[model samples]
Target: MTTLLLAAKAAVAVLLLASGGAKLADLAGFAGTVRLFAPARSSGWVVAAVRHAAVMIAAAELMVGAVSLCWPALTWVNLAVLTLTCGFVIAAGLGYARHRGRPCHCFGALTKRGFGLSSLLRAAVVLAAAIASCMPVRPAPQLHFTLVFHLLLLAGAVLMAAAAAAAAKALLTQPDSAGTVA
Candidate 1:
């Protein structure tokens, strides 16, 4: 069970890192998704606000995920992840209901999945993983990571984020089936 919990935690952390990095790679695309949820406001400030919000959301995910992965002992980080997962679930449901076939850009150009049942299902799975990660592991002392280990973990997290960003950027620049940039 402890091993399962640890795996769950790592899975969600990696997901967050990848999603955040991908979003950062295509902020304009992610901003469009954010604009969808906005209160139908059409103003310069509103556009700027949505862009800022998208950037902040991506940054928060990256920071929280990196911290959680590098220091699993911080139990509060589990709850933080759970909270973020809850938001994702809500967004997924809302996006599915309101924007059926619209591309969510949830993973930037790395994925072409639109707002639909698949999106909802994926969000649910992520939520489940996050919940499982919050479960208490027995004899926590059995895993005592040193400062060096934590630093190494952090480095790996950064690398994962950078790779995801690079992949998304490449996908964004590539021509689509219609001979248009994605």
Candidate 2:
């Protein structure tokens, strides 16, 4: 049971971190997509607000991932994961309903498809994993650091770094309307 919980926790942490890192990589592109769904995009202030909100959401996901990895035993961490998963589910549902064919920008550039049933299903599965991690269990006397666990963490870190680099490169090379990098 402990092993299962640890695996789930690790998986969720990796997912959150990867998603957050991807968003942080190309915040402008992410913000542009966000603006599409926003209720108001008429004013410059509103656009700025949307962009800021996008950054906040990404940062929140990253924080949650870090906390979950560092302290998986805490019930609050599990609850936070569950909450974030639920939010994702809801957001995917709403996006599917309204912006059915638009790119979700979920994994940054990795995922290009628009929100759909698949997106909802993915979120639901994550939510289930989060719930499973929340189930009551006797706390272990000490946290076990297995080879698999270490490998998982390492892989996640590498993926996040790669994604962030790609995003940064894209951001840096993006040309403004004046045909020059901003």
Candidate 3:
């Protein structure tokens, strides 16, 4: 049961970190998606401010997940991560409903390959998983596994962000430059 709990914690951290990192990597795209749902479409400055806020919130999520999972001190991070997941649920639902058949910029290109209800449901479940991690944990002497898991997770996140940037650059460049991006 203790091992199960640890696995759950690790999975939740991975899911949250991935989603948050994806959102943070594409601020303008996420903001544009938010603007579609938001009422502040007319005001240019309002849209920009709202977009930045969304990015900041996503940044908070990425940081919280990393710290809570990788760092030794638990430090109320589980609570913060749970809160972040709940917020993401709200955003995903709202984004889904508002789009009404449009693509979501939530997961960026990652989800574009395949869309599923399970994805959204999994995010909701992750909220519970995060809170569970906050509960009284069993005495597990294997701290090294935890450390290794988190480091690998963090490294994967960095690579994913880099991949997103590369994809975005490729998409933005014109056809004139085949191998070379303008």
Q: Which candidate comes out best when scored by lDDT? A: 1
**Candidate 2 lDDT score relative to the true structure:** 0.74
> Higher TM-score: candidate 1 or 2?
1
Off by over 4 Å in 2: 142-182
Residues 90-131, model 1: lDDT tens digits: 999999999777878888889877788999999999999999
Better of 1 and 2 by lDDT: 1
The TM-score-based order of candidates, best leading, equals 1, 2, 3
Q: Point out where model 3 deviates above 4 Å.
A: 113-119, 140-182
The stretch of ten residues in a row with the least summed lDDT in candidate 2 is 173-182
For all candidates in order, the CA lDDT equals 0.90, 0.74, 0.62
- Cα lDDT tens digits, model 3, 97-179, are 55444445556444442113644676578777876776656564443456577688568766654565456444433322122
lDDT, candidate 2, at 165: 41
What is the RMSD, in Å, between candidate 2 and the native fold over all Cα?
Answer: 6.3
Candidate 1, superposed: residue stretches over 4 Å from native: 175-182
lDDT-based ranking: 1, 2, 3
